[model samples]
Target: MYESVLVATDGSDSADRAVDAALDLASVFDATLYAVSVVDTRRYGDSALSGTEDIVSDLETQANELLDAVEKRADGGVMTELRHGKPHAEISDYATAIDADLLVLGNRGRESGEVIGSTAERIVRFVDRPVLTI
Candidate 1:
């Protein structure tokens, strides 16, 4: 009975899997699929480094590309967004803002090394919605 399915992706392998799963669920439920890619600006800190702007620009570009790939793979029926912030916070807030019926995410992202990625773990704990981690 899901009406809106939101998936967060970082262009990582596991995120890709999550995308596929989200697509399947959306298709099955006839739900609208929404995809998001966050630039993780927190990693850059608040310092005014010389190349900080360039680095953030590059990250933004990558985020757009990742969102583009997801939309392309979805065959042009998905809504997408690019955000600059902490992954967990951005994603969870987005889910709530969109009133998503379900939130899907990768078990681990690019920076993950433990049993579960910190972002996914945090989202699962904090987001007040059902999360399906792939």
Candidate 2:
């Protein structure tokens, strides 16, 4: 019974699955789909610090492409967004801003650990919205 569905992706396989799941739900509910990709700016600052802008730009470009791919697969009435910040914070903020009915994301990411990726876990903790993990 969602009206607006937000899917957060990181261009990973798990995120792709999440996108697919979100798309299915959107199709079923006839809801608007919003895809978002968050670039982790902290990595550039924490690493050895070279080609930071280039790296961030590259990430943004990749994220845009990924979102475009998802948009192509969507049934219709879908929009995409690309942001730079902590993944969880950005996704949550976007959900709040859009008044999304549901937020979909991967249970784990490419860089996830034994416990859980910080982004997924943090989003679950911080957001009051319903989250569907794929």
Q: What do the candidate models score in CA lDDT, each in turn? A: 0.91, 0.86
RMSD per model, one decimal: 1.3, 1.9
Candidate with the greatest TM-score versus the true structure:
1
Cα lDDT of model 1 by residue, 49-115, tens digit: 3456888889889999989988888898899999878899999889988999999999999877877
Q: What lDDT would candidate 1 get against the real structure?
A: 0.91
lDDT for model 2 comes to 0.86
The alpha-carbon root-mean-square deviation between model 2 and the true structure, to one decimal in Å, is 1.9
Candidate 1 off by > 4 Å = 48-51
Report the C-alpha lDDT of model 2 over 33-104, residue by residue, as the tens digit: 999998887876756345556777788898889888887888445788899877888899999999999999
| Per-candidate count of clashing residue pairs (backbone under 3 Å) | 0, 0
